[model samples]
Target: MSTLLKPEAVNRPSMAAQAAESVVIVMAGADQLPVRRKGGAKPVSVDLLAALVEAALPDGFGGVSRIGFETAWEAMAPETRRALTDDLTCYLGWSASEKRQAFPADPEDLVRYLRWLEQGRGFRPATLTRRIASISRIHRMLSLSSRDTLPTRAAMVADALKAARRRRGSQQRQAAGVRLGPMMNPQDEVEGVTLAMLFSVCTSDLQGLRDGALLAVAFESGLRVSELAAIHIRDVDPQADGRGILTIGKTKTDQEGEGRYAWLSVDTMRRIGAWLEASGLEDGPLFRRVGVDRRQGRPARAPQDYFSIPGHTRHWQERLQGRPAEPPLARYAIGEGPLTRQGIGVIYKRLVRAVIDEGMVELEPGREGDLVRAISTHSMRVGLTQDLFASGEDGAGVCQAIGWRSVSTALRYVRKQSVKGGAVSRVMDGLRR
Candidate 1:
């Protein structure tokens, strides 16, 4: 069983100090501020955490021993807390359904749960691994406060997990890329959905302008969906060369708020300017939802037929009584809230479909569905990584440009292009057939 380390034994903030800081920040509504702390903003609300705990845990935080968990919660990053809570909630729900005690999970029960997740639910290895980690972490927390033991650390459970992993290989599926054309030759033909193709399908209306700017900025900055949604008008500044530089106050990799800057091409800047001008948004979220309300116009009034049925005659008479024809009109309402991550994915798919329907792009016979399924929020980020690799940029350079803290993470997206230009390919290609 994994042992719970004393919070004080680690290099964590003092419990007293963290509690005071959390209170002060919560009262001041620091999370709601657009600008953030040195690291990323602690946007997760304490109330939300408490509610999740109360609903998920068998016994709520009525006891004094569990106060340590609350204190430890304050020290965690916002994303970590959110993920753990979600994982915990899911496991607890399953435990309750199975009539099992979750705090001190049984080794046999844990193994059974793993099998259900893998076989019954058809979860991938990564998800099963994360679920195990979540159970272990929660048990560790309970061990710190209560008498719970770490059943996840049991040898039988470990062996079961190993066997399961062996049965189901651990390869992860990478999201398909929405690549721009070749970096060195920007005008070169790209087979799949390219950034240029997506732009071509974007019209001049409010929704189109917003989508264009969003895709352009996402591609240029290599921002994750959450980071893209958090972008503000105030964070972007135009440059002398007609391009612009965006100040990313915080990113998934740079949560400590040691901010980074991303370059925006002249084309991207122009699209952003058009979106901002059309939407008349000066500040707040850069990409907000544009609600479309379309009203169909009525044609010129028709003369009422005297022999018509009573209801039809009355309707026609009313229309003929000086009701003028209305023109078809579409109105766009800009929302105050930013586009959600899901909304961004939907936008990408919608535009991709549009481009295909307009004949700007084509797919192999019976392979159209595969392309659509592969495109995801990560597509833009993957495309950026691959484009950099294709342009002869090193992995480290790509990591820095894309705000990846580890070179290993960036390596995941450098497959086809990197292989084509590797040492083996170079030596063979150098000697003509």
Candidate 2:
């Protein structure tokens, strides 16, 4: 079991202040001696002595909390602390390593370390370069004199930065051409559900009702996943005419320190009302999961021991299982929360997978020749945007309805269908002229 250390335990002497001074003595590997103070009460200096030993412990971001650092320092011997401080200072200057032969001999080790950072640590090229820069800064700071030539380290950092930039540029170029083409066909007309397909997907059940409501909102409002997830039940003002007005708290492009609201179609209100009533959810999270019994292929009649409204529950694990639940069913409950990042990803993946598996929609193959099938929840937003633009909705109207901060961001979603229609219209007009 891991131990928790409190910062208050090491209040006698500040460890950070002594680190530089303690390193010099620790590296020489000499036994520590007690010193007497002149005309002063002698405080027990054992904690300071023990700090030396703690300095030699492994360095990592994981265990480097302020409390942990203090606890480790308090536990070390003063002699060890002094020696380590000396060695660290010397290593920083690259002088002690030459004398004691502590530096790695093989150049291959550095390359291996870089690979390990990229693969194991999942560091992006930019992140890896930053890490190298941090090391270079440390070497410069710790070197005894300013004139020390750390040319090798400087050269390695420069080469890594150049490679990182080249890789980033190549990725941006590739992405600009057909990034969404793999996940969706921009040219394909909206074919699957039309407004009728939306009605077919709706069910009397709470979960089904909620799904229906989400679909209605997506279809009518053309809300982005982030905008949809951020919505609260209170933000939706249901009208008697079956239409509703939604007050969006924030959007992707607009972090402008304020929220915006918009009116939606009547169909959206009806679906949302059906869902809220069926779910028995009076307030709080707009969407929630039902307690499923995999063994019986049904939902629980009464609230299970683990049923909780979103936000009140800290983790998804709490809602996952009962005393007897199948592995497949248990997997469904894991990490699902309303309006969470993970929850959005999970919902989108499941929705797309279900649509594809049930043959409700057929997505085109990615790229020109590749047969790899792809579809995602974001396709709904893209599809809707394309549909609107093709219908001759002006750019300002589209931007306002979609809650886009910039016209350019919305234009990216305006697919080839819109462009092609415009081209055909122009040609027809030319013939008349």
Candidate 3:
């Protein structure tokens, strides 16, 4: 993976910065393509863009000329480019297997595809929504280039999407929250894994120290996995009260580079300090990959006389020489690069298992897998939102705290618990008491 770009490193020429040096909009199928400096980064290849444009064209039809495709590719964010590439590739592959045209997709065929995705492939509505958006965006790009009609905008496709929504429901499955308390809502008496439970299971080992700090910081700040992984050493500011303030230079919502702040408790601060001291990291990304080397110990044995097991001979000889058996040992190697978002999710799940093993968070038999599957990289963010809502914080407060652009998005996370504190519940409680 490429090194993560620093939030404030525009002055340092990176791949993204270098790519901007060469882009020049020109006519379709121009004599020469845009050229970067000798060592500068190259744009996405024309061949791949051509293939996508080709796949998007209907039978005996051509649209989205070379320059048009190039312009669309150039305008996309790196993340969007990667996602769209995958989405289009998947659609084309599926269409080929089904022996159907993918580009300028027919409404009837599109409905069949949507059915296959939902019923046959067991895809969620959210995944279907994204796939549809990918198709729509491609069609829109083509329409802009060649004045072609948008197929995805057809009424049939809209009706198919509406039917899918009714069948599957539009509410997405949310990651389970890892609240600060055992019971996210005390009135409900619902108990689950908590940050306190996780912290209790965190050992003094290098992995434990890092996991503790990572979870603590993530929970307090309600940072998404990408933002959590991008945390640098300099982003932390210590407060006089022992708590610290974390500066988030960029977020999914705040793309303008305007920073936001979150409070970190003294406990979280101490965990961060412990991890830094143990890892001996003076700078750069705070969370990093930790490689563990474990050497297993073997029991001392007498030298083999009559028959010898091939690999056991050396161990037998050592035992005969009276040398003590090697003790089991584990050493951790810290990585220089930041932990990826996927890596952070793995760490969270591993810690969840550890907490379960330690009996800090208990579950009914056969439900362990369910709990593990429910918690994800977004668990900390979801957990923090629920915690805030349970504590009487409104939607606006949650929006501001978590840097959400809208109250509706913030409220979506706590929809289940909101009813417990609603007017009906309050009125009923008063009458009953």
- What C-alpha root-mean-square deviation, in Å, does candidate 1 show against the real structure? 14.3
Give the per-residue lDDT digits (tens) of candidate 2, residues 81-185: 344444333333332333322122122333444455666655567555554543333333333124345432645545755665665532211111112122233
Q: Comparing 1 and 2 by lDDT, which wins?
A: 1
RMSD of each: 14.3, 22.3, 12.6
Candidates 2 and 3 compared: the better one by TM-score is 3
Q: How does each model score on lDDT? A: 0.73, 0.47, 0.74
Query: Taking the tens digit of each residue's C-alpha lDDT, what string does model 3 give over 133-238?
Result: 8877877666633424566666887788888889989999988888887554556444578888777777656677788889889999999887998899888877
TM-score of each prediction = 0.80, 0.47, 0.78
The candidate that wins on lDDT is 3
Q: Candidate 1 on 1-433: residue-level lDDT in tens? A: 1211112211223456433332111111223423322543334555555565555555653432357677767666656777777777777778889998766577888888888888999988788778888778666655533323467777888787788778987777888888886555432234588898888888756678788889889999999888999999888888776778889986666767899999998777777877776566777889876666566667766655555537545466564454656665665666677777767888899888887788776677787777888889999999888888777788889988998878888887765557667788778876976
TM-score, predicted candidate 3 vs. hidden true structure: 0.78
Clashing pairs in 3: none
**209 in model 1: Cα distance from truth in Å?**
0.3
Once superposed on the true structure, which residue ranges of model 1 sit more than 4 Å away at CA?
1-67, 76-78, 143-150, 183-191, 301-312, 315-323
Q: For residue 272, give model 1's deviation from the true position in Å.
A: 0.7
Cα error of candidate 2 at position 59, Å: 11
* Model 3 spans > 4 angstroms off: 1-82, 144-149, 182-190, 296-328
